[model samples]
Target: MPLGDEPVSFTTMVRGREIRYDRDAINAYLGRLFTLPHGEELCAFQKQLSRGNWDIPLMTRTLLRRNGGFEYSAAQNPLRVLRDEMATFTQLLLLLVLHNIQPCSHT
Candidate 1:
């Protein structure tokens, strides 16, 4: 992302068309991409990111929609871009493993 491509918001704010979703939708989306233990629970942030989609102007992605909308990226695998869910997944892994919390993605 360029320096001023998107407004810098310290807090979570929808300045433009942003993909917002509830917990259920987040779980449903990420559940397919990753497999977790049978009884593990994904944190609030993890669930929130699973349903996230980003579309910055002037940047073209194979699946990023030209026009920001509520369209789901169900067909687009997040691991390709190393954004959104990847960061969230990394955070989850770090919190669990580095801190010795027993990672949820553990097989």
Candidate 2:
């Protein structure tokens, strides 16, 4: 449990290294510290991907006619592709945390 906007954990011990490391704790702390902000990052990345070479934000600078209706820009790729990429990224991120799998980086 955490206080309003406390941004700290209530489950951590003050003086020792002992702590809960079960599936429940992992589930609880998914947003605490040992996690990547996949949802937020993916949204930004998807927007970047969608706006790959565009200078403006997509859907914000649409053409507004005299009738106050706007025409959306055509998408380079189907929205499904972005959804699939985001889903795969999220799934792999969660799996890594839940399974305690170490991510190996070649870089």
lDDT of 2 by residue, 1-107 (tens): 67688755535665887577664687777855444476553556687777665443333223221223223447543222122323344546657876676556544
Clashes of 1: 0
Per-model CA lDDT versus the true structure: 0.49, 0.49
Which sections of candidate 2 miss by over 4 Å?
1-15, 31-107
> In model 1, how large is the Cα lDDT of residue 85?
30
Residues 58-82, candidate 1: write the lDDT tens digits: 2333323333222236785433433
Q: How accurate is candidate 1 locally (lDDT)?
A: 0.49
Question: RMSD (Cα, Å) of candidate 2?
Answer: 14.8
Candidate 1 residue runs with Cα over 4 Å from true position: 1-15, 21-32, 42-107
